[model samples]
Target chain A: MTTGVRRRLGVEERRQQLIGVALELFSRRSPDEVSIDEIASAAGISRPLVYHYFPGKLSLYEAALQRAADDLAARFVEPHEGPLGARLLRVMGRYFDFVDEHGPGFSALMRGGPAVPAGGTYAMSTVSTTNALIDSVRQAAYVQILSHLGVTDPPARLELVVRSWISLAESTALIWLDGRRIPRAELESQLVHDFAALASVSAAYDEEMGALLRRVFKEEPADGPFADLAGRLLTLAT
Target chain B: MTTGVRRRLGVEERRQQLIGVALELFSRRSPDEVSIDEIASAAGISRPLVYHYFPGKLSLYEAALQRAADDLAARFVEPHEGPLGARLLRVMGRYFDFVDEHGPGFSALMRGGPAVPAGGTYAMSTVSTTNALIDSVRQAAYVQILSHLGVTDPPARLELVVRSWISLAESTALIWLDGRRIPRAELESQLVHDFAALASVSAAYDEEMGALLRRVFKEEPADGPFADLAGRLLTLAT
Candidate 1:
């Protein structure tokens, strides 16, 4: 045991150190695969000391997940200039970059199990506040996102559409990570174009989306996606 | 042992009967949850008699899975009547109907497990022909699907789009099965529209898609989805 030279770290600092070590371990493998002994060894502390900071592996894993979520949420905080699609492209670019960086963790978080299992000794459902806290953070980012998309008074269907698009992006991102079946840049464009296409379709049935679509097109460039797509549709009639 | 009462049966017929019993049990819960004891009890036979037809649980499960796979492929066989999208809707309706009917088995099939894992004396991986048969059946359906979409002279991009659209349908189907978030009819329409939107976007960048899309439009209803979408796009410019 390396118990001879115990450093007198403050409670908060020691907790952070343990968490940092835990995050590194959790990032490599799923939480279920990781063990308490691994975290303690990596932190250069005994098992009891690791437990002192966090009650169990689930707690340690949650903290590490929070760290990654915070990093991802920060990437969406973008300047609202240029065309709406371009702005979203940058936001998505950042999102993809973060996914690329935290490949394993991003996948685990997206999978979100033991997190929302029907039964577990230390299930995420028992920790009600964790989900609440995460949802609050996520909803705030979606609010920022809706504003940039000019979706001020989003209809119920539009809200569902936006949320569904997010889920699609997550699933497609996972596939891209594994297969690179389509090029990364095309993947990004495909998602952007999908958003635009869905918005146009939504505009047909959703009153709020019509105004939102026009506003998006107003700021969009003459030769860009907005104009290009409209031209294609017009060509159908001519 | 019902040795005195047991009827004389052909080997293949007994094998089919045992597989049918196993499929019913598998259709209720996942393959992992099922046990040989339960299967024998359900079939009103002894455990050894259960083994007489199939060596173990894994073999039975694979046979059950193969049955479901064949059933699913059969559902996609729609007569090419009405619009292409309408034809696809009928195909998807059958698909979703199958999913609804065989909920647990459908999920397990999709999960495609090592459900009956190690030490299974009759493991499925050893039955190499089962996978080949399923894959060949699946490829034939994909070929049929590509033809229906007018994807003649398909480029690599078209193939990716076809395959990605399939994934989207699947992911969305799973979501529908769980949430019923959108009405099944709307889900079908949304998927159909998503395919059309993707095709148009693809047409712009792909020569093969450009030809394929026009051919699709030539056969499409003037006042149906094509006109409706073009009208919506024209609304944007004016």
Candidate 2:
């Protein structure tokens, strides 16, 4: 038994540990509901020690939010080898996994936590930081989707299609988290098909998007989500 | 002459006039930046008269927001029209008209006005009321879409497609207002096509949605947005 021994952590390590602990607590409850005392207790540290690492709860909340944002952004990354539809499905899967794991925290983050002060420069900056983090996540996703399309300079229509799809995926996830009524697998595949749908519509209006879709479709397997969407739409013709 | 006469107004009319004046002021600038004195002056009344009608700026702001919400909701209404696509296009057009007219107010409403207080039951209730108004708009749009589809009871998939499109349209408008690089007419039509795209993908997954799409397509003209979507997807075949 090593009950008597206590280990000392380096400055950065202690901070990271506290963030990790705070995030865990926040994952289960809204950040506003979880106090600094609870976070310190969870990490086996004194309240003063917690304050030593971070000035206050708002700062700690921001640190935890930063960690969560990074994790969320990483979920969008996938290998370039697979078909685009399949890649997007995997991304949605991981995204939902994160949402499922961090329910209240995710909602609080997106909806703006209950504790958010209505006024004050300090509170305003915190809100802006929170917004900036959220925007960064959206930007990361936009870049990832563009990379999947392999387009460095996208036409305006293409940009709209991509950006709109990202927003669709986001709202879908947020609403899904509310009741989770539909099967996750079905929503995942449907979202992948949604991308195809948005792109197809954009392609109709823009030659550049048309060309991009053709290029995307050529790489798709017959049973892939993109082809699957084609097969479904074709049923109407018969 | 008539110019020397001061027109007397009833209490309700005066209150309505104040709200209209406040809404006009709020449309151009964020509500926080607009003061009661300005509203009073804009209405050609004294500041005490403005206070008599409303307790504080927040209450008046809420009233303005309520008026805006009703106006926004009315934009979604279309008389059970010829083609769903054309009807949706009209809806989007009018919707964007509101966004275009109330640019700052629209942004401030959706983003939460900069002056929102961080805490206090009064402020918290205001936030909830604001959120409730926003949700009412979404719900109104949802009901309107369902009515256009002529479905009293929709499947989960159908609900998902409609709700997701609503969210997509919202985010699209919010993003569009930032720089408004694309032509508004094009976006309005694209949004109509977006609805078709979202539904088509859902139809591919659910037989009920498939049946609904087939029924919908039968009435749609060859050049309609729905058929146009089908036509675009057919291009991938060649």
Candidate 3:
């Protein structure tokens, strides 16, 4: 007779379960509003068991956030098949969808809190990894587009364009999430169109830059950290 | 000897004093972190006097915020002088400078929070005003540019473009305030260059647009709400 709690789960499985529950609670309230006792009770687990796993509420919150962040960085940064514009759109969509799905959590993370919560340290390197990936892709795409269009500008201009695109995309997503201005489909369509306008201006593929991007897309295994991240995201989200 | 404190001030003068003190305290900490006691003490006034002038901390905070918002709305929404690009750059610079000068207060206003003491109520009209002004200016600019160019896209597409530009400008400002890699001068130059790139594609009647922009620039009045907001802002800072 197999009981629901009879089957033993591995450490990874239990850890994942803890993170899953934590994410939901964190998303429901600001950081200051959530407490470990609430999390433990909601999870139907003992306080001691929760403490053993997370050390503290802050540690638990950070761990959950890190998992989500790493999952996103891995998915978006990984090289993939498709035109640079298409690839960029897909990555941006993933991010927007994440925010849309987890509104309060995203708000807390981006806006931060009154003080650094005990567990939530300012992890610059972790966040920068994502930013750097975006910069690199943007630079490559910008160079490709500008060269094709016969616009003579320094490589730095490409950085500015890409960053601007990112800034706009982020704000747009945030506003959409906050305002519920349109249905999700309409919002995403508008986002794609807006992205294409900017991308079309900056993603003209020159021979050499195209070749470099192609190589980056090919040499790296398709099933890399990015795919892993996507897989994790699916597991948590679905 | 006519001591500065001896003479009874008018309603406007007293209101200004309360707003100044409120802005100063709100900027330094979350509304929850501040107290009426602290505000009165800091302003060199009695607690009862503070309450007499303004019902509560929330009212004082909103009054101060409303003035700032009104100034920003007038500047960004109302007609201004100069080329659209240059005008936008100047307005954006002013916005950034305002944020830089009164970061704590600005930050508090930007991040809408739950009514912290029993009397405090969260209001986000200031952010809305900023968005509306940006939209208005961008829309007017787009119409002029498109009419000049004699090319047409659907209104939706135009909205996307304008929204994209405004969002980028705003998010760029946010990043700048966050003290990220983008310096003020570099951000300005990049924004101008990108604006040019877009305008070059979309703009027509190069000479006419320039002339009209110049006239608009000349007509812009400096002695307005922005000056008033600045004056009020300085009072709060001390």
For candidate 3, write residues A1-238 as lDDT tens digits. 1113435557777677778788777876665577777777776677787887777775677677766665554545525454444555566566666766667766655542222244433333333332344345445444544443335653433444555665665556655566564455545544433443333233222234333333433442445432332233223212
> Which stretches of model 2 miss by more than 4 angstroms?
A1-6, A46-49, A112-122, B1-8, B112-122
Task: For candidate 3, give the docking quality class from DockQ.
Answer: incorrect
Task: State the DockQ of every prediction.
Answer: 0.12, 0.44, 0.09
Steric collisions counted per model: 0, 7, 13
Candidate no. 3 TM-score: 0.50
| Predicted chain B of candidate 2, TM-score versus the true chain B | 0.92
Flag regions of model 3 displaced more than 4 Å.
A1-15, A22-63, A80-90, A93-164, A175-238, B1-6, B10-13, B22-42, B46-63, B80-90, B93-97, B107-160, B177-238
Lowest summed lDDT window (length 10), candidate 3 chain A: A229-238
- Expressed as tens digits, the lDDT of each residue in B1-238 for candidate 1 is 1223267668898777778778877877766678898888776678998888887777787787777778878887887677786777677788778767766765544432224443432222322344465455556567778878755665666776665566556656655665565577766666667677766776765566777788777777776656566666667569
Local lDDT at B180 for model 3: 47
User: Tens-digit lDDT track for model 3 on B104-174?
Assistant: 55554443322344432223332234335444545555564454333465343334445556557655565
Q: List TM-score per model, in order.
A: 0.64, 0.89, 0.50
Error of model 1, residue A56, in angstroms: 3.5
Among residues 3 or more apart in sequence or in different chains, the pairs in candidate 1 whose N, CA or C atoms overlap within 3 Å are none
Identify the runs in model 1 with alpha carbons over 4 angstroms from their true place: A1-8, A28-48, A108-141, A150-153, A205-208, A223-225, A228-238, B1-83, B95-184, B202-231, B235-238
- DockQ rank order: 2, 1, 3
Query: In candidate 2, what are the lDDT values of residues A15-37, reduced to their tens digit?
Result: 99888888888888876688777
